[model samples]
Structure formats: C-alpha cells, structure tokens
Target: MGKLYVVGIGPGSIENMTIRAMGAIKNSQIIIGYTKYIDIIKSLIENKKVFSTGMRGELDRCRQALQLSRNNVVSIVSTGDSGIYGMAGLILELKKDEQVEVIPGITASSAAGSVVGAPLMHDNCNISLSDLMTPYELIKKRVELAASGDFVISFYNPKSHGRPYYLKECMGIVKKYRGGSTPVAVVKNALREGQEFQIFTMDSFEEDKVDMMSIVIVGNSNSYLKEGRFITPRGYKLMD
Candidate 1:
C-alpha cells in the first residue's frame, strides 16, 4: 500500500509554500485538489496526474484521492493550511488502511495579515463566513462572541455570488460590538501576483467589495490605522 499526503500550498504562492508540501507533491504519483487550487500550483505539478473538482465536491475528491493512494503515492492539496479549512480531516476519516500524513502550510489569515500590516499581533481569531457546512446561526453566535471579546478577527470565505448576504449579516453583528470606526483590512488574492489590499473602517466597510478569494481582517478595540497600515498592538510595556 502506498502512502497518502495531505498538503497545504499556502496562499497560492510558490514562495509561501512549505518545503515539505512541495516534497510531498514531487514524490506523489497523483495529485488531487479543487480546480482553482490545482491551477494555482500547476507549474509544480507538471508531469503528475492531477484530479480536480469544483465547489461542494469535497467528499468525492477525498474518496478519489484515497482510492488512488491504495496503489500509488498520492498528495491531496489545499490552498492555505490543509487542517484549517482543507481536506485533511475528510481524508483521515476515510483512510481505511492507507498510511496518511498531513503537511501544514501558511494559512490565508496570516498571509493576508502579513500583507496588510500587523493586525494579528495581538489576540485574534479566524472565522469563516461561508455557511455551506456550518449553520449561519452558529457562525453568528461565534462572531458575536469574538467581537464582544475585542479579538482581532480574520474572516475566511467571506462572500460568494450564492451566499452574498452572509458577510453582510456577519458585519452587522461585528458592528454591534465594535465601534463604526474600527480598523479593518480586506486582502484579496493574498501573496499572489495580483494581490490587492484595502484598509477601511467598520462603518465604511462595504460587503459588496469582497468575494470568496478575499480575507477580511478586523481590528480589536485597541487597533488603529497609521501610515496606511492597519496595526493591532500587542499589549506590552516598552522599556524607556
């Protein structure tokens, strides 16, 4: 039996990918991932047999990857940390008898944070606004609590054509706790060639401006904007 490796490719940037992730892909005879994610690493997967699927095909993709792993070394890839919102858990649940390993990569939250500024330097939490698998009620509750606690928030899968209203609802919950002037950053295609970073305030934030590829970083009560960078300071006394 061959081994299965679940790898995270990071924010769709080769430079952001971990060495172990690349090694896994290079060693595998087959590579599987979401259609767009596979396209992101197309150069690295040159000669390998790649299988891709569109949205909502997670289960099918996992099964296919495992089936191939039974006879050939396989690497299932995900953009950002696989364990974060990737295929690692689904693969493990159906592994049956295959030897499996999970390789971590730079998650979009951190990647987007790095590109915009230091918004995550203080206490933070990552929340996905996509309600495909998770219920919106639970997501709303979590967002409410996170905002009430004044934690810097990283929002993933913030919006899509089908679920456009979810982000608006989430932002409403956030605005209830955080002041309208709270700092926020919208990072689109983080770490990729066509990256776009926009800094705005909670009141001025527009839900229509974001999409599935965007990662939204909202600052805590103590966060601020300075010199075009959104900064969330870690509470620490400085030595004079």
Candidate 2:
C-alpha cells in the first residue's frame, strides 16, 4: 500500500503554505482537491496527475484519493489547515489501514487574524456558519456558548446565496452575550490577491460585506480596536 498525505495549502497563497505541505505535494504522484484549491497550487503541481471536483464533491475526492493511494503516493489538498473543516477527518474515517499523514498549514482564522491584527491573541473558537452538514440550531448554540465564554469567535462559510440569513442570526445570538461595541473583523481572500478587510463594531457590522470567501472574527468583551487594528488583550500588563 502507498502513502496518503493530507495537505493544507493555506489561504491560496504559496507564501502562506508551510514547507511540509509543499514537500508533500511535490513528492506525491497524484493530487486531489477541490477545483479552487487546485487552481491555487497549479504552478507547483505541473506534470503531476491532478483530480479536482467542484463544491460538494468532497466524498468523491476523498474516496478517489484513497483508492489511488493504494498504488501511488497521493496528496489530497485542503485550502486551509486540513484538519480545520478540511479533508483530513474524512480521509482518516474512510481509510481501512493506509499510512496517512496530515500536514498542517495555516487555517483561515489564522490568516484573517493576521490580516486584521491580533484579534485571536486570547482564547478563541472557530465556528462554521454553514449548516449543510451541521444542524442550524447546534451552530447557534455554539455561537452563544463561545460568546458567553468570552472566546474570540471566527466564523467560516459565513454566508452564501442559499444561507444568507444564517450569519445574521448567529450574530444576534452573540449580541445577547457580547456588547454592541465589541470589535469584529471581516476579512476576504486573506493573504491572496484582492485581499481586503474591514473592522466594525458588533452593532455596526454590515452583513452585506461578507460571503463564502470571507472569514468573520468577532472579538471577545476584552477585545478592542486601536487605530485600524483589531486586538484582544492577553492580560499582560504593560508600562505606560
């Protein structure tokens, strides 16, 4: 049996990707991933066999990768860290006895956090607003718990045409625990071309500015905005 490597490509930028992730892809005989992620690493996968599928074909891609790995070294790529809402879990669940290696890379939360400032300096949790796989009620409860616990919350798949209202509803739950002035950062295409971010208060956040490509970070109660940066204090006293 051959090796199966699950790689995280890190925010669609080669510069953001970890060296191990690049090495895994370079050493693999076959590459499998979503279409968008494949395009991001097109330059690196030249002369290699690549299998890409569009949105919602995750099962097929993982199965194909597993089958191919039985004969050749296969690398399945995820946009961000493979374990974070990525293919690593699915691959591990399906593997019978294959040698699998998960190569971690920078996740969207980290990428967005770096772009906006230090919003994730303290305790934080990543919550996906997309309810296609997870129940909507559970998603809301997670949001509420995170907010009440004063953990910085990073929302993935915040909005799409089909689930436009989910983000607003979750934000409402968060508002009940967090103050209206809590800092929030909406970062789009983090670390990639056309990257942009906007910082706003919880009450002033514009849902229209977010979509599937964006990662929204809502700061904890202690978080604040300084100049243009969003920050969450880590409780280290500083001299004035």
Candidate 3:
C-alpha cells in the first residue's frame, strides 16, 4: 500500500509552506484540498492529479484521497497546522489499513499573531467559533475561560452563512470577563497576496465586518498597546 502525507500549507500563501511540505507535494502522485487553497499553488503541482472540494465536501474529499493513497502517494493539504482543526482528523478517520504522515505548517492563529505584532508570545489559546459539529456551549465556555485567564485568543471560523451570530455571542462572553477596550485583530487572509489586516479594540469589532475567511484575535486582559503595536509577553523566565 502507498503512503499518504497530510500537509499543512499555512494560511493561504506558498511562502508559509514548509520545505518538508514542498518536498512531500513534489513526491506525491495526487494532491487534494479545498479549491480556493489549491488554486494558490496549482502551478507547483502540474504533474500530479489534483482534487478540489467545496466547503461541505470534507468527507468526500477524505475518502477520495484515501482511495488514491491506496494506489499512489497522496498528499492532502490544509491551511494551518494539521492538529488544529485541520484535514488530518478526517484523513485519520477514513484510514483503515493505510499509513499517513502529517507535515505541520504555521497555523493562521500564529501567523495572525505575528502579523499584528507579538501578542501570542504570552498566554494564548486557539479556539474555533464554527459550531457545525461541535456545540456552541463548549465554544462559549472556552471564550469565558480564555477571557478570565487573560489568555490571548485566536479564533477560527469566526463567521459563516447562518453562523454569523456566533462571533457576536463570543464577543459578549469575552467582554463579560475582560474589558471592552481589549485589543483585537481581525487578520484576514494573513500573509496572502491580498492579505487584509484590521486592527480594532474588542469593543470596536463589528461582527458584520468579519466572515469565515477571517481569524479574530482577542487580546488578554493584561494585553497592552505599546510602541504603536499590540504586545503580550509570555512571562520571562530565568534560565539559571
């Protein structure tokens, strides 16, 4: 049986992809991913059989990739770290007797933090606002805890068609424990060709301004604006 490589391409830019992912893609006979993401690196994989899917075809995509892997080396690419709500989950779920390897990438959460400044260096937690399969109550609980603990929060799937209200609800939860003046960055399409970075305070974030393509980062209670930048220190330690 052939092997599969679950690669994280990092946000929406080829530059963010790791050398290892590049190598894997080059060696793979089949490549699969969400259409828009695959389009970004289409030129790089001209020799491979490409499979693209839409938002709701995740299961179909995984199954097809697995079947392809049974005969040839296949690589399914995700936007961020495969462990953080990425395609690795679906691939593993579809796996029966096949082997797979996961290649990590710079997650949107981390890339967003870096683009906006250094707010992630301190306490931070990554959360997904999408409630397609998961319960909203759990997501709300996480926001509450992250807010109370003053942990910088990187939120994925902030909004979608019927789920636009999810982001608004999250804002309310965070505001309950944290101040409204807290820093928030709506890093959209981070590091991509058309990347748009919007800076706002927690109170200033209008839910309508955000969508599924964006990642919302809510700064911690201790997060401060310094040198015209948003910063969060991870708490210095003495090596001695």
Q: Which candidate's lDDT is highest?
A: 2
The lDDT for every candidate, in the order shown, is: 0.91, 0.93, 0.84
Report the C-alpha lDDT of model 1 over 141-182, residue by residue, as the tens digit.
Answer: 999999999899999999887887888888888888888878
Ranking by TM-score: 2, 1, 3
**Superposition error at 238 for model 1 (Å):** 2.1
RMSD of each: 1.4, 0.9, 2.4
Clashing pairs in 3: none
Q: Residue 15 in candidate 1 has what lDDT?
A: 90
Name the runs in model 3 displaced over 4 angstroms.
Answer: 237-240
Residue 105 lDDT, candidate 3, scale 0-100: 90
Which tens-of-lDDT digit does each residue in 2-119 have in candidate 3?
9899988887788888999899999998899889868977977997799999988888888988888988999988878876788898888779998799899989888888888888
Better of 1 and 3 by TM-score: 1
Give me the displacement of residue 81 in model 1, in angstroms: 0.6
Off by over 4 Å in 1: none
Candidate 2 — which residues are off by over 4 angstroms? none
Q: Give per-model TM-scores.
A: 0.95, 0.98, 0.92
Over the full model, what C-alpha lDDT does candidate 1 score relative to the true structure?
0.91
